[model samples]
Target: MRKINYKDITNQQLIDVRTQHDYQAGHLKNSLNLNPGNFKTYATYYLDLNQPVIFIVGSEEEGHLEELSESANELGFNQKNGYLLIDEVPKEDLQTTETILAEDFLNKSDDFILLDVRHPDEITRPAPEKNLVNIPFEDLVNDYQSLDTSKQIFTLCGSGNRSTAAASFLESKGLNPKVIEGGMKAIQEIGK
Candidate 1:
């Protein structure tokens, strides 16, 4: 497999195979954080097999890079596109997306499009607002064009993982989407 230097990656989709806590601490802008446990499944759901994907692993754990590379190969990701060692990239080159907390989102519900990225069956509970648009993350790659690009989209999932992926996908498509930090679980807690 090829190894990529951080500065050379211009248009390739970046997938960070790191623990969620590490990812949330800091990650490349628009990079999708695929937790090791869900890497295979998330790759299947969000990745376009034809597009080039660059995997980013923490410099402290170079050992995990090979394992992540193997997992990507098994999931049909072309290994020739290569991996990136996160520490090699300058701190200024990395950035995090904006995330709205559940309570904060609820307060501004009228100003944003509430996008529920959960599966249809998983949405047994009704949304707090009537502006909810149900488009599961699995269908986003194909159905994103149907959404109104004019409005700001706030994405939510069962917890928060799927929404992060959804927001990254939306951003790639040039749509502004903010991930709801705590997702439905936070909303439920607020209701209680």
Candidate 2:
């Protein structure tokens, strides 16, 4: 894989390899957030193999750049252009999404909608019966349009990670999404 620069890839697809939190704080315009953990599943659904895709990785995530690139190739996207160290992109130019903690979220009654992004098998218990939408993260690519776009949505998963990614996607869809920071972990703790 080749190391590339941001200026060169403006016309190409940019996949941000940082965590959802880092991505929400700042990220390149039109770049997709596909952290390596969800790279396989997420990319499989959203990526267009024909269009060249470049990865943008932070120092902490640089180690997985090659792994993601390889996975992209294996998934039939051989045109993976290269990668960009996130440091090269100006922080002021990055975009962001919002996030809220479980504790704070629970206090709100009907102000927001809850989108549980966890897999069905991982759901050992039921989500809150009200104001909740259960759509697994992988299914979001297909089911996103089914979501209620009138209200702010809080994306929840096992940890804050996937929700952040989910929220990023929702944000891209012209919907308002806030990640449930700490995800189900925070909700579980609050329940105890």
Q: List the residue pairs that clash in candidate 2.
A: none
What is the C-alpha local distance difference test score of each model? 0.77, 0.81
| TM-score, cand. 1 | 0.83
Which residue runs does candidate 1 get wrong by more than 4 Å? 1-3, 19-26, 50-52, 59-63
lDDT of 1 by residue, 51-153 (tens): 7888888865567676777887787875366788888889887766568888888788355678998888878666666578988877887898988888888
lDDT score for candidate 2 against the true structure: 0.81
On TM-score, the candidate that comes out on top is 2
lDDT of 1: 0.77
- TM for every model, in the order presented, reads 0.83, 0.92
lDDT of 1 at 181: 79
The lowest-lDDT stretch of 10 consecutive residues in candidate 1 is: 17-26
